[model samples]
Target chain A: SQTIHQWPATLVQPVGSPLSLECTVEGTSNPNLYWYRQAAGRGLQLLFYSVGIGQISSEVPQNLSASRPQDRQFILSSKKLLLSDSGFYLCAWSRGSSYNEQFFGPGTRLTVL
Target chain B: AQSVTQPDIHITVSEGASLELRCNYSYGATPYLFWYVQSPGQGLQLLLKYFSGDTLVQGIKGFEAEFKRSQSSFNLRKPSVHWSDAAEYFCAVALPMEYGNKLVFGAGTILRVKS
Candidate 1:
């Protein structure tokens, strides 16, 4: 069975600080990875998705960026965090087709103060 | 462009009552629809998905959704609601692009079951 893991389950950072959130998937290779932010009532907003190593497609252009350094490892980073950047970040993986069902990680709750 | 709309923002129902959540979508070509449930402050769990063949798709937790092509709607339904069913439900539509398909999500509907 495949499982996804995300770290720093909860994070608190001061404004203008650098941020990094990691996501890794086990038991699957060449899986498509995605980063999403969940707001109060706006639902899940796709931030970035990676098809392979060094390939990242950004859905929303903001203070955040994503990278796929390894086949199953995805990282979401921010050079400088903004107050608006605070939200619950979720990492997901899908096998074969991107349209297939995605499995989500536990998620990272970011609080930028 | 593909978009999804979950009409009801909040729905309350009795624990033993039937539950239905409305979802509408707009897309240029054939749409891939999905339903996901999120417990408070947690990641989404896929309830069901509709790709082809059957118009009705069954998912985990005794949940099902019917896809109406003409109506451009994929509504999720459950025969008997449980207290554990209280959560936020999201409707998503997959928009295919050159690179990959992006899932466009609705605002989401909050389901509250009264026991």
Candidate 2:
């Protein structure tokens, strides 16, 4: 089966600190990658998605960026963290065929204080 | 633009009772629909998906959903509820081929089971 691994499962950073959240899938190839954030009591919001290595599409503009250095490895970065950056961050991947269901990562709970 | 609406924020039902959750979507074409479940502190799990075929789709954990294009609704149902079924359910829609398979999700409806 496919498994998604996300690191630093829980993080707490000071304001203006840098941020990096990693996601990697272990059982698929050429999968589509995505990043989503969910504030408490809110729905998941799409932040970024990648179809392949070096190709990224941002759904919303903010202080974050995404990179796909390898087929299964994706990274979300920020130069300076803001208070509003604290949320549940999830990484998901899907086969680039039809409307294949997306599999989500365990997710990282970020606390920016 | 593509959007999904889950009218109910929370619902409570007794065990062994029938369950139904409503979902509605807005898109230009035949939107691809999906239902997902999320346990506390876990990622979203795909329960079922509707792409192009039959309107009624069966999913894991004894859950099923029906797609009604005329009503722009895809409602989820369970014949009998169990305590283990207490979780958050999400309704999502993917715009045909125009959006490159991006899924737009609605505010999830949380389900609570009464013993």
Candidate 3:
């Protein structure tokens, strides 16, 4: 069975602080990874996706950036966090095939104050 | 360009009543549709997906969705509602290009089931 893991299930960061969120997948190889942010009572907004290591495609250019340092390991970072950067950040993994059913991680709830 | 639309922002139903959520999509090619559920403070879970060969697809947690090519819709249904079924539902359509893995999602439908 494949499983995705995210770190810092809950995070509270002050404004203008650096941020880092990590996501990793187990039991799968060369899986596509994605980062999504869901606003309160709103839909998910795709931030970034990676097909392979060092191949990150950002959907929305904002204060956040994503990097695939290695296969199955993705990182979301921010140089300086803003109030708008606080949201429920979810990491997902899908097979490289056409089926592409995304499996989500536990998620990280970020609160900026 | 491919896009998904979930017309219902909020839906309320009784515990034992049949529930249906409407979803419409727009795409040039045959769309790959998917239904997902998200509980409060949890990640989205795939309830069902429609690729081909089946108009009606059954998913986990006793949820089913029907794909109508004519209407460009894939509506989700549950015969009987449960309090546990009260959650946010999302409709997604996969892009039919070289980057087929990327999906475009709708605004989502929030379900509130009364006891």
Candidate 4:
């Protein structure tokens, strides 16, 4: 069975600090990866997605960026974090087809103070 | 623009009672619909998806949703509610893009099961 893993289950960062969140999938290769953020009272918003290595698509312009350094490894980073960047970040993986359902990781809770 | 609407922000039901959560979408055509659930501080789990064929789709955790084209709605229902069912439910629509499909999620409805 395939599983998705995310690091730093919880994080507390000061404003203007650098941030990095990592996600990796095991038992699958060349899977589609996605990054999403969920605010306190809002639904999830897609931040970025990658179909392959070195290929990342930004769904919305914001302070975050994503990179696919390996086939199954994806990283979400920011040079300087903002207060608005505090939220629950999720990492998901799906099969190659667009019709496939996405599998999510445990997620990372980032509190920017 | 394509969007998903979950009318109920929060719902409370007694244990073993019937439950229904509403969802509506606005799109040019029939798009892929989905239902997901999220426990507090956890990621969303795929409950069900509607691609084509039957209007009613069965999902995990004894959940089912019916897709009504005329009304542009896909409402989730459960015959009996359980205390463990308390969670946030989200309705999503897949918007096909040039590169890939993007899922637009609703504001979500939080279900509170009272025993």
Candidate 5:
């Protein structure tokens, strides 16, 4: 069974502070990784996705960026956080096949004040 | 462009009652559709997915969805509801191969179960 883990289950950061959220998948190798954000009372929005190590694609331009340093590890980083950055961040992975069904992690609740 | 619409924002049903949730999507070609469930403050769990072959797909937790291409709808249904079934349901559609397999989600429908 594949499992995705995200760190810092909940975070509270001051405005202009740096941000880093980590996501790693166990029991799967070379899977497709993705980062999604869900604002309060809103749907999930794709922020970034990675096909392999050192490859990251940004779906929407904003203050954040993503990096895949390892086959199973993905990191979302920001030099400075904004108030609008507060939201529930999720990490997902899918099989690198034609039929891709994403599996999500527990997610991190980030509150930027 | 790909988009999804879940007409109902929220729905209430009694235990043991039948349930149905509507979903619609707009895409240029054959779309990959999925239904997911999310408990409050938690991540999404895939209930079912429709890629091809089967128009009616069965999912976990006694949930099923039907894909209607002509209508551009993938509606979820449950034979009987349970209190534990209270959660938010999301309908999503994946863009064509040229779009990098990104999923566009609907606003979601919150399901409330009455005892």
Candidate 6:
């Protein structure tokens, strides 16, 4: 079975500090990866998605960026974090099809203070 | 543009009671629909999805949803509610693209099951 992993499970970062969140999938190759943020009491917002290595698509313009360094490894990064950047970050993988279901990771809770 | 709407922000039901959550979408044509559940501080779980045929779709955790194209709605229902079912439910629509589809999620409805 395929599984997604994300870390650190929880993070506390100072304003203007750098941010880095990593996501990886096992038991699958060339899977579609996505990055999403969920604010408190709100639904998810898609930040970025990648269909293959070195290919990333931004869904919305914001303070975050994504990179697919490897086939199954995706990273979300920011040169400088903002207070609004604080939220629960989720990483998901799909079978590269429109009808396939997405599998989500445990998620990372980043608190920017 | 395609979008999803979940009317209820929160709902409370007694254990073993019937439950229904409303979802409506705005799209030009019939799009792929899905239902997901999220526990507090956890990621979303795929409950069910409707692509074509079978207006009613069964999902995990004893949950199901019916797609009504005439009303542009896909509402989730469960015959009996359980305490463990207390969580946030989200409705999503797939926006087709050349390579894949982008999912637009609703604001979500939080279900509170009281025993």
lDDT of every predicted structure (CA atoms): 0.91, 0.91, 0.91, 0.92, 0.93, 0.92
- Chain A TM-score for model 5, please? 0.98
Error of 5 at A44 (Å): 0.6
- Compared with the true structure, model 3 gives a TM-score of 0.98
Report the C-alpha lDDT of model 2 over B15-108, residue by residue, as the tens digit.
9999999999998877889999998878999999898788999999999999999999999999999999999999998753345568889899
lDDT minimum window of 10 residues, candidate 3 chain A: A94-103
> What's the C-alpha lDDT at position B7 in model 4?
91
Reproduced native contacts, each prediction: 0.46, 0.50, 0.46, 0.38, 0.40, 0.44
Q: Pairing residues by index, what is the TM-score of model 2?
A: 0.95
Worst 10 residues of 6 chain B by lDDT: B94-103
Stretches > 4 Å off in candidate 5: none
Show pairs that collide, candidate 5.
Answer: none
**Top of the candidates by TM-score:** 3
Error of 3 at A43 (Å): 0.7
User: B1-115 in candidate 1: lDDT tens per residue?
Assistant: 6789999999999999999999999998888899999998788999999999999999999999999999999999999999999999999887654546668889999999998
Q: Please report the candidate that would top lDDT against the real structure.
A: 5
TM, chain A, every candidate = 0.97, 0.98, 0.98, 0.99, 0.98, 0.98
Clashing pairs in 6: none
Using Cα atoms with residue i matched to residue i, what is each candidate's TM-score against the true structure?
Answer: 0.95, 0.95, 0.98, 0.95, 0.95, 0.96
lDDT by residue for model 5 over B1-115, one digit each (tens)? 6789999999999999999999999988888999999999999999999999989999999999999999999999999999999999999987543455667899999999999
Give the alpha carbon lDDT tens digit for every residue of A2-113 in model 2. 8999997999999999999999999889988999999888889999988889989999889999999999999999999999999999999988875767899999999999
TM-score of 1: 0.95
The CA-based lDDT of model 2 is what?
0.91
lDDT of 6 at B16: 100
Interface RMSD of 4: 1.7
Count of backbone collisions in candidate 4:
0
Candidate DockQ values, in order, are: 0.60, 0.65, 0.62, 0.58, 0.59, 0.63
Cα lDDT, model 5, residue B93: 85
* lDDT by residue for model 4 (A44-87), tens: 88899988899899989999999998999999999999999999
